[model samples]
Target: MKSLVALNSNDPELYLLLRHILEAEGYDLRLLVDVEDLDHLLKVGRLHAVILDCTPDNESSLICARLKLGGQSTPVAALIPSDGNAQYMKLIKAGVDEGMLRPLAPSRLLQFLRHQPNGASADGELGVLAEGKSLRQHVLEMDLEAQRVRYNGRHFGLPPIGFRLLACFLKSPNRILSREHLIAAAWRDTACVKQRTVDIHIARLRRRLHAITGSEMIRTVRFVGYVLQPHKNTRNPGSDVFQRG
Candidate 1:
């Protein structure tokens, strides 16, 4: 099937440019001027990717957050202003997959879409995850392609940073992960992220995991860091599984 991409943009010129380019490359493009329309489409349609025009007043970042929180892993790319560092950071934290600086190049947008696992060619061949396999520990499984976490038969979505932090913890289960290690794993622009930010996102991840498993799977180690513990109901529930590193 031809990949379908949704463009949430008010710019007629940019829409025309992307439609022409994507169609030529064997993709179908849908242009949406309203955020409500985009949200509705997301609920009913299978979008390979979403392109957002991050106008100063637009809720592109908010939309990105909603899409991720709602368990939709469709790739989202934002067209941001040339000097939109603050906006870019907001979108990243909101779970946007990519951001292209405006005066946006059609080629760059095409390249971004082509790189997404969902953005396959007209021949229907699927793309692969560059990160390789899903991380599994006990009953918890992180589906990289679906971008959701499964725990004890329940599935849930997380913000991008939350997802990465959980992946780090899962990769080294029962081992303490320092803030620096988590920052390296979770944030692309780590220099600006403080240790406190890591704590906050970890708290969020912990809450989500708790909601799914109904037990504290992550244990904080004072000034050291945090470790992922096996579920309380698992075999040897009282065992000392947490390893400090």
Candidate 2:
């Protein structure tokens, strides 16, 4: 059977372009202009994937969050404006699998769809929680499936961005991660994110970790970026130890 994909968009041009591309590739395309219909459609049928047009108001981000929180595993891609840095971040935090800049190329759209669940490159891995895998770093354990972190025998929830930021740190423990690198990993290459924004988020993440570990796991490099120390170390003077930046 051909794969069925849904496009929730109000742009006629996008609809026509994607319909041509998808039908030519032997896929079934469904266009939905009204957001109200999405819930009903989800109840009645199965979709291989969903592509959303992320408007300035970001109604689509809410829809993507609903889909994920409702236990739907369908992959969601969003078409966003090139300069919509804030909107792009919101979409990613809302569980969008991919974001493509608007005036999108046909090749890019095709490539994204082809890697979806039942698409040509479907590798059975969906999101950050791929294959129920968990990431570990010293005393910190991240349950990707649960979107929670375990430390000191307690489980705590983090915002999606926080979770991703910590995952990046865990992947490269005991290494200094520049603000640029953390932005790329946590915000998915949103170039307009200010350095201060990274500082704020890192401060918030530090507070979350501090609540659990009661010791500093992240250290500031003074004019450089921050480093993740997997094992607790209080020997370093002038570290971000117990102090929120």
Candidate 3:
């Protein structure tokens, strides 16, 4: 059984749009214009994520605040048009885990949901990772069958492209991986994002690794590509010093 999602939106077309984006292989979604079902599902811990399409009147922001008060850890993503800085801050204050603009990108949306703590998984649906030998590198442990990684005894996971990119690098440690190589390895016909998307995912992966190790894991090669290696405290005088972006 896929994980359930409760979607409540005031706009009919917006609700349908969200459903089309969210109701994928790993998710089962309930589309509701009213919040009673959402409230019940959330209270019972039956939903993984709630997508709120806020109206110009800010009804969904109020709903977001109410859900936060309900004390559920489930993520609430606000699907809204661009608002002023003040109104956007209000949405954040009201507890929107993610804010997405109009013309939603399903790939990005899926990435957000997959990384959420209580994400969906379908029945008998195996992990996206290939089952093989465990890739153990220091604090990193990859359970290929589970498609999950544990760092410092804390479990972690990433979106498909991120996972693929990390795996490609880990499988060939201490090697420079060009963006083109990564595109072939991590993204074949899967996503429509540009190669620069690899840079964003690499940056995210670097942050996660630094969180656990307190040092850089991946290094940018200036005009070249990237390379993943252990952070060296001391640097060679000939090599230029690299800083985090």
Candidate 4:
């Protein structure tokens, strides 16, 4: 069965509303009133998505940001009160895929569930492949099923966030990736993050890349963001980077 976790620290009434809507649709609902619970849940495995209630105190954007920083690919949907604009853009910047205001229409809610990638099996989904068993050079190859990085015929291990960030650069090679873009691509929604968090992760990635290759394959375009540059000689015979414009 598909699982959907709900994170809302302050609103029981809203929780009740979500329970009725998702349970009726046959989703296994895991209710989390506090954000800390999300940390533990994320460590276990991926979920279809996380639905967060937007409030004055606990915003969905922060939740989304932290999730991306930790490398969880689950999509996030933010529920705002039915009223004015309510800073939906903030949620987008934080890494939320879709933002809806309550009372949500049944059709729209169903559409969101149906389109989520988390429910799909691996054979039907995309994947990341590191370059051919190398960690020293800056270039990493990505495809629908694998990611590989090559350096002297050796491979380096990368965590999920590192892999996602590197893959984003491989797809865009020398182009400057602003923190906002990196966060969006890496997180796939902007209702839960801050820009500074992106910077910190980038710094960590740079260190790891340098340690392996002894050269800065990833560069910072000051006042802009980071760029990926692959080594000249190391190329995988079968992999080509895919870019989404």
Candidate 5:
């Protein structure tokens, strides 16, 4: 399931632009223009992040106050005028998790929503992301703590590299990751492993997932890469509501 992000902005033009862009990044969004609407969404406690337009004076402070009042740890980013440092400090003191300069760039917004610090985009998060197994279901579970995967009441341990490769797939569900991308993720850039090494590891990883779950979760993309196929009925209600009524 994708994360839910609320955009509370005063600018209709910018709001419309951000809506489409964020939605494309796989977020469930709620556009809130009214204070009452923002309050309601915060109280619901389902929002993972909030994009607040600081165009109006004190609006950022009020929004941050409301989030604090609701006692939810939801992150907030204030979109302010790019002219001065005055508004920047105001938004920072108002408790916004991040601040963005106007004339928004695509990567800036993406990094803000994804909580990437130092302007680090998804491309830089390759090997760092595949260290865990947070997405598990459909009678198959990958436990990072135990370094083993469980399926059909049986436990299996993947080879060291195989585990890393599977963790990479688990981190990147539904995204087409190329063989080169997989190689970069599972192995350091020492130029030692060839592209065929990635294929071998993928084949082994698929066998592990299939042996346990009885379903192939990874799919090949001819001339491209691979993607993790999710279960038919599995959905994270916390993040995704698409599969829900």
Candidate 6:
């Protein structure tokens, strides 16, 4: 069964509508009334995607941010009020997969769900995404299966958390990954880790990659998070060098 996480507080009508729509399409829906409930549900569920109802009182953006931080791979779709582009931007920065306006049409919800990864049970998992095999110095290439880093033909093994964090940056090169997203990607299960834990891992990854490539492979955007910036001379205009998610 395809599991889901829905965030909306006290809107029985909205919940009922979603239940009917999703049940008809053969989905097992899990309703989340608040952030705490959503956090609890995520621990035991292999979710497909999250449907966030963006009512004025519904803090869907914050909730989605927390879920993304917790390593939940479920794609998030935010339902905003018609005039709520500001909220939409916030959701996007929080790593939401898509956004729609309320009252949500059943067809739209189904459309978003259809595009998500079919999970491992369907057609096998999505493999490592790469632009090409030949990686240049200072550029990032991930072995998604082995969680190894290959730069300038040298290999550097990564810890599980570091690998996940680097994968987030590789998947979205040049985009600023906020500290919240990094934390969600690195330490999603526990809230006890110091916020500096992300910094520690990033620093370690940076040093290791630099040592292997003999160049600064990762750049830190002040007040923002890290990004993988390839050397200008190494870029191939026609060749696929950097992979994008």
Q: Quote the lDDT for 42 in model 2.
A: 81
lDDT of 6 at 216: 68
TM-score order of candidates, top first: 1, 2, 3, 6, 4, 5
Q: Which ten residues in a row have the lowest lDDT in candidate 2?
A: 236-245
Q: Write the per-residue lDDT of candidate 5 for residues 133-209, one digit (tens) a residue.
A: 34354444566544456654587755445656776776666789988777766654324445655666677678767
TM-scores for candidates 1 onward, in order: 0.64, 0.56, 0.53, 0.48, 0.45, 0.51
lDDT tens per residue, model 3, 118-232: 4564221123434464565555666554556766578865544456777777666678888887777765333333455567667867876787668888889886789877655
Error of 4 at 113 (Å): 6.9
lDDT of 5 at 138: 45
lDDT of each: 0.72, 0.70, 0.62, 0.60, 0.62, 0.62
In candidate 6, what are the lDDT values of residues 87-107, reduced to their tens digit? 666666565655566666677
Question: Any runs in candidate 1 off by more than 4 Å, and if so which?
Answer: 24-26, 65-75, 85-134, 143-148, 155-162, 178-180, 186-204, 219-226, 235-245
The per-prediction CA RMSD against the true structure, in angstroms, equals 5.6, 8.0, 8.5, 7.5, 16.2, 10.4
Top candidate on lDDT is: 1
Give the per-residue Cα lDDT of candidate 2 at 162.
69
Most TM-score-accurate candidate: 1
- Clashing pairs for model 2 are none
Give the Cα-based TM-score of candidate 2 against the true structure. 0.56
- Give the winner by lDDT: 4 or 5: 5
